[model samples]
Target: MANKDVEIVKSSGKRVKFSFDKLRGSLKRAGADEKTINHILDIVRDELYQGISTKEIYNRAYALLKGKETFLASRYSLKKAIYNLGPTGFPFEKFIGAILKYSGYKVEIGKILNGLCVSHEVDVLAEKHSEFILVECKFHSEEGRNCNVKVPLYINSRYIDVKQKWNGINSNKPLTEGWVVTNTRFTVDAVKYGNCAGLHLLSWDYPKGNALKDRIDRVGLYPVTVSTLLSSEEKQFLLDRNIVLCRQLIEESFMLDHLGVSENRKQKIIHEINKLCNL
Candidate 1:
């Protein structure tokens, strides 16, 4: 007889039927080869229980991928890797600035701009030609936390104040736009409010085809947290020193020397970085 359907428990404790298609699709998006994906699916299928936690499944699949291809495994852990950006959101803000920079925009992190009624500290300021955008970066270390309506509400309030000031003084310049960027999903209310308020909202998987994850993958700007080869202390070392992106290591080769690992392991780490970054 065929094996009974397996129930997988999410981090929220909600249980649902296991989906091979979903698993395969995510693996593919992470750049896993077909052979490796099949092998992992087979392993998870055998180990399946009546009610297996999704975390367990992810860990198992990641472990298998790490052994086969460390870089692919890193890509698989992109979401968690983002959380490793900081004990605070400062590093994440810098990382986003870097991403925008890669896309040919001039980016500034931590700018103080004058608003209509008050001065505000902007998380990021990006400019391309005459277009200027003020961004608020919201970082969360935990999974499943959504950016809520209040976040956009507050950001829009600040943006309007600043835009009003800019318009009154610099009418010839391009109008300023506002965005609230998060590393997770957004609440339904948040999406509705952002739409109604005419503010741009960028999240992990929001706005259909054009989300933060999609943009990051489009430019191969994977962060250091994705690397399974790097231990927690090693990853922390890089993060503490402001080495957030995988491409940064490529740009500054000396950073690897600080890791103090064997040359062989270091080479493997470099190889993984190249594979993930498509270098």
Candidate 2:
């Protein structure tokens, strides 16, 4: 148990008392059984120290989980795996497109369109039934970041411009939904403005039960980056080949052979992904 007096620093540099429940909840979310969860908590508790960054705590817990169950560790490290998609938002945008496509949305990414006043480039355009959705994705490489009101404000204006032109062109009126998606959280004002302006805001944990994390968990549309068995170079290789989803990797297991991975290692990779994808 962390001492009530023990304060940990967040990635944002805010200091707060470390809560056992918070840590336990994260572990449980990774599908760890009660006994394993308790064991991880006990080990993490003993390693706790004042002013310890939450990142350190997470690392400790993840290491413990990995040592016990590799699959559990991969699931536990899902968020971190997302961060690894960066240095650029293109991969993140592709990731969002995959999620939407998997969820039955017809997705088009990085399209150029004419707005009412000017031509604009849309990050992702999703069409489902009578609705056409425009999504702008913000991917942050670092943790503890928040998308502020300015983001939605900017995205809203662009969507409004595009919506005017789009609605004018079609005889059959379609519902237009403008969305701002991020890998981080949103500021209170950002959420407020998004709701007020009728823009859908999505982040890792926002929108209560329908946030990105919820969608990923519900659909099991995890990125290939989430595989623990793949090394950094191997993961990058997969991503470079546009094999973003673990499901994609499963179908294209030939890529493993193309990379000249050993038969023994190939079997392990296949096993890890099959188990991770619940196959």
Candidate 2, residues 1-279, lDDT tens digits: the string is: 438789999999999999999988888888899999999888877888999999999888988888887878888888999999987888899999999998889999999978999988999999888688999999999998889999999999999999999888964856379999999999999999999999999999989999998888777778888888888888889888888888899899999998889999989888877777787
Poorly placed runs, candidate 2 (over 4 Å): 173-175
Best by lDDT: 2
Q: Which stretches of candidate 1 lie over 4 Å from their true place?
A: 1-5
True-vs-predicted CA distance for residue 109, candidate 1, Å: 0.8
Tens-place lDDT per residue, model 1, 1-279, is 123478888876788988989889878988888998999899988888987898899999888887887777888888878977766888899889888888888988899989989999999999888788999998987776778889999999999999999778877665568889999889999999999998899999988788988888888998888887888888778877878788998787687787678889888888889999999
Q: What's the lDDT for all of these models?
A: 0.86, 0.89
TM value for model 2: 0.97
lDDT for 92 (candidate 1): 91
The Cα error of candidate 2 at residue 3, in Å, is 1.5
Task: State model 1's lDDT.
Answer: 0.86
